[model samples]
Target: MVRAENLIVKAKCFIPIPPNPKNILSLKSTITSLMVDKGFEPENPTISGPTAGDAGVYYTFTACTTDPEGDNVRYQFDWGDGSVTTGWYASGTEVSLSHSWSSSGGYVVRVRARDVYGAWSGWSGLVVVIGEACPYVYAWNGSAYVLDNNVLVESEVSNGSDVEDFYKLEQAMAPYYAGDHFSVYSIMLGEFENEHSFIDMVRLYAVDHDSSVKIALTPDGQILTYSNPNPPVSAVDNYGYDWLSSLSEIDEIYYQGFPGDYLLLDFGSLDVSQAAKLVLRANLEWKKETCIHVQTLNETGEWEDAAILRTRNRWSTIIVDLADYLPNPEGTVKIRLYMTGVHKIDFVGLDTTVEQEYTITEATLFYAEHSESGKVTLKLLKSDDKYAELLPGEQIRLYFILPNKPADKNRSFIIQIEGHYYAIQ
Candidate 1:
């Protein structure tokens, strides 16, 4: 028999040469035949799924492929976020997979198939666009709605009750791209107040205007489109000797007092028609513990004590709520400070402590639309289930459960909600 080395050399020299020497097409066919004899790859995969979806929400996608040689096949997926499937699936099978994007953007999902011989086919890709989980938020920039990328609404705390120590939060909500209107589907509880805290009621309000507006809301739920914290239009004393003492807080030039001394202050025309609460503030001191009676002129032309101040020897500031005694058809409010025992007054003044500027009635659902002509029009809106359109320069307020007692100060919380914007043509 021939030597084994000679047989191996002869086998290596036997190449698959085409019968037609100058036929390029035949040569190509011969090469293709040799490749097929080794192994045939699977066909490229076809991907099918939703091309658009919300971020952080999962969606289903399907991929399918067939092998050219009818051999068993496997598939691998590229998720397009620098991630890929670690496992492979059977060939010629319609595989379904669910995936979610953590953020909003555009992504490309790709898949490829491989036969039993490990020959991978060309990759097939599908494009997907992910929208924000929350609605597109916009803020009224005094004229038009501008895109608000932050998608957060914030506010500062105010004293809820005039006498009791309680707090209320107020904020101006940004308008969302609802095309026309929107509805509150549900509220998703996130990092809000403490476990002990809860919302009592939710009040919704809206206003329509083509220009900017300066608006504020009081703790008692009154809307204010006018001036606030208005100081006494004029301050005067009974004696007229120390007229400016109550207006300015100066120690040396203060109004020295006797038992029956009184100071009168006049706060010019005020619109208390929609008044919720009014408060009076004064700066007083006493040589001995004394009493100062805060009196307001009622409609019957009689002076009544709205609040009483039991003073200590040192100078102290006092606030008296005067909600009940402030209705005057003439629109003028007069305050009198009657003293008992020895007392010294550094400053005496009157201010409107009504923090809320507007009120939205839950029953009738009234919204105040302010016109440039200093006119306010009451517009009726739908109930809590439905919300009115929020135009530019308008505002929206959310009411929560009032606290029973004062909690720790400087603490923080977050509020989250879920809703859908409608596109109405």
Candidate 2:
């Protein structure tokens, strides 16, 4: 229980030794309106700051509070690592403190505030973790977000979690038997980060069926690659029955075809606007003299031609950039594929690509499609010298940069891991 004059009595001894009578009177007056005398504690101080960092490296933590009675205030800190603050700090005007943990683990940071009368506020708390790794934190350094590291290691991910990160063919894949096509609007990798990191390799993975693949990457940073892929239906829109064809799938490949007969390839939503670049990709199969045509919807919602099949008699593929065709450049868009003749289409796919920025010394691009039958486990080296295992369908992406120069637009390769083969065009 506190009374106005009671504060004056409690505060008397704490006043400067042999305090001047006038000074003591002034202190008594101020105590009358102090936050503690009003029966209120300083609003519990708040802690807001990064939750992770590397040991022995300075990490800034923010502490904030307000005194209801508007008294001048100061703050005290408990670093949670057995470190003590020098003393109470002037906090009515501003507040923040920097600390470095001595070891790796989690810590609970506690802070509190005190009014001019020396009335202590309730403890405010925050939790932070320290790591033994070099890349300690990811944050903005005023002008840009920086990944703290001596040698930057880039990273990227896509597990068909969203079409914006990675796009695929129309939810329905029944039109032609061998050679069909689709397009994807991809964004520049740097857009996701504050800046761009060099690209090293492009990896692809698929399920069910494999054939010839061809790709063309245009200098415009538009991805033009080809492969015979039927991505999992799990990547389809989380909602909607608007499939590529009005007719139901008959065999996942065969469809009735005729002149002017068309099956739409829905790019759906690329989920990006104003992308600095595009990744136009597809999968197709063709026989001699048989052809298919592809088109994209523009910002104006108009369908326009994007590409034409050139499979000579044997099956061929084109996994390349369609620089001339930008789908839903202003928002989300879908592509349409028209059958120019009665031909059996084999495999067709569309994927979007974006570049990335690095934060560590090095990063390994990893991917696994979501499915009902099984799961894929991804592993990464952790700060504790142990491998960290990631559950299936968690993160799907590859982050890397070419060693000497920029990744060649004309570059191509094939990678195989865990009984799966990836043809990068």
Candidate 3:
């Protein structure tokens, strides 16, 4: 028992006990009176910066205090803007704190601190916060907002996966489509780069029946030329439908002259705002003895034979330059056909014809000065013929044949006749 009492005395010597509760109370009261005299509060309070608008700025405050018996101190802040914070500091020095607001508006921020004895100081002066405004962005898909420039523009997707689709330039110029029939508009934005501005939401519509028609937009939001295929089909046989199957079964040969059939192609009424080159292509499958001839009505109202193509057991394509045949063309452009040998015609495709316009200068036809004996070389010189001369800087078309062909068949051949020289240009 004596040894234990000794141990207790040694422990007391190592860790000293705090002052008596009554003594501590008296000291705290004295310190509180001193703080009151110094215009300091024992309870630390707070004030905050402004709460709203574009004046992006904010702030907090700090207070000072001390006790007769010095003790570690702390701080607390209440930004009247609905935010509160706390910190620790030395007994009687000034404490500073700050914050930034994201918009242009006023906010009140306040700060306060406390001592180790649960004594808080009164809040300091209020700090004001300000903010500034910024720009917004938007985007559109066929229907609802798919993406904004600020957001990711997702690919056309359905059933939890990306689906293939095509976009038409016509849709991009909506409401305006009625006035401008062939006017093209951009279908996608940021195709060139991911940078976009001034938009809210991008609308997108799902392509249900034909997924192939949805097109992707270029970086510049331009419509791409190679669009997905969703070709239209006809309900009847006369519309080139079933034409392919009809030519597949050919068992018997008709000895007598076969029935001749023809098709009339209508170009329809279209307003071409600018000069363009148009090419019309026709694909057909016929028998060995089948011969196809294409004729067009010129601006003079005269039907001219454009091309004559002969084919066997394969598919053949015929191309015609509409600019050469149709003039400020209005109404239906008819394609009259002549068929012999009981051959079947299948699959005819028509494209909107584009015409290419060019100028032809006058030229002269002259004979070559240097020539080998026995060799008759005739050169085409620049004559007064408006369609004959090769212009100095212009590219001209030329056609040539050996000395044994028919001149009548070679009537309209292209040739570039420069000064003292005749060559195919």
Candidate 4:
């Protein structure tokens, strides 16, 4: 129950001295919208600054307020960790301050304003979130994604729940078997400066598969190579229909043949436009220097001799270059096998070699991670695209293609993969 002008009251008394009245001391009190007046107070200060910032970095904040009585005002800041009071400033003035946090977390910043008359305003608060200075990384395990620091990574090809090793090479060369020739390897990131670090912009290098019948690698980088051997989609022979199923099979069972008879093999759609080399691969059992004439149909639909195969008394692999016989490089390739004498045909297929980029009719590359929920497909990381993150307790799976079972018992092939990742701090 106070009026505006009578919010507070005060009194003053002066006492005179005998000798020096002019030096008399006086007690004074009054209400001139001053400390004794409780009706006027400064407005609540408002805080303005960043709501989120990195730890260990200094950030700026501003506080401002207005006083009702036109009195000078000063600001008090509760930085959440400590309190700071600033010098006096004119009413409606904005005061700026800077602060930093040592660790990462959320903090509540508060500010208040007080006038020279000793009237204070209510406090204003703001929330700020401090983040770490670096980003986090995670890796894909055979089962699930996990932190990179939780498991030990190996350097070789691994099987089962164990983390697959990095920088391991595996090769397969079996010309005698159907669908069993390929080389594969894997890449992983095991060494890092910090547990929370990650990498990106990875690239792979390698040589072509046709440089030699064996696997070879350059010193500068590992090689990525694959072979595509397609079997005849359909087969026709004047002799019998029972042996047509055996034309594409690699087992010991063969197609019994008659002298001077011919068998035609039709391989479905093929892409030889980018082929480094095209060859007809076949397995035949011959006796006594007997020969088979590899032929192709010409524009006139007549059988033309392509190559002569000569082998004796054993099962031998025959490789004939078909480059000169291709009529349409991107269309289906058909061939005829004409025997000069009685022989057995075990298997026949067309093998294509690629030097650089080539389209895959079927998926030869596969990536899988282990988890209680079974295997999951992860995004393929590329140099110019977004990369993957691996956290602790996680592992990477091996990259694999088609399996290889060599016709020659001593044949071995190897595929290698290298991963390069740059950690962002």
Best by TM-score: 4
Task: Give the per-residue lDDT of model 2 (tens digit) for 1-425.
Answer: 47454454435455345758988898777665453453656777888776656778987877877877677677787888664543444445557788888865446678888776667788877556565211111222233222221111112122211111112212212211122232111111111112222222222212221123333333212334343222212222113333333222323443334446565544454432322122222222222233456666766777666665432212222343443465456554454556554443343444443332221112123332212212222332112222222221121222222222122222232221111111122
Q: What is the TM-score of each candidate against the true structure?
A: 0.28, 0.26, 0.21, 0.30
Model 1 lDDT tens row, 385-416: 33223322222332222222122222111222
Q: How well does model 3 score by local distance difference test?
A: 0.32
lDDT, candidate 3, 169-246, per-residue tens: 112212111122221111222111111121212222221122222222222222221111111122122234323223
lDDT of 3 at 257: 17
Compute the lDDT for candidate 1: 0.44
RMSD (CA, Å), each prediction = 23.8, 21.5, 32.9, 28.7
Q: Is candidate 1 or candidate 4 better by lDDT?
A: 4
Residue 370 error, candidate 4, Å = 57
Worst 10-residue lDDT window for candidate 3 reads 410-419
* Best-matching candidate per lDDT: 4
Question: Cα miss at 124, model 3 (Å)?
Answer: 99
Off by over 4 Å in 3: 1-259, 271-290, 299-302, 327-331, 340-343, 353-425
Sort every candidate by TM-score, greatest first: 4, 1, 2, 3
lDDT score, candidate 4: 0.50
Query: Sorted by lDDT, highest first, which candidate order results?
Result: 4, 1, 2, 3
TM-score of 2: 0.26
lDDT of 4 at 394: 32
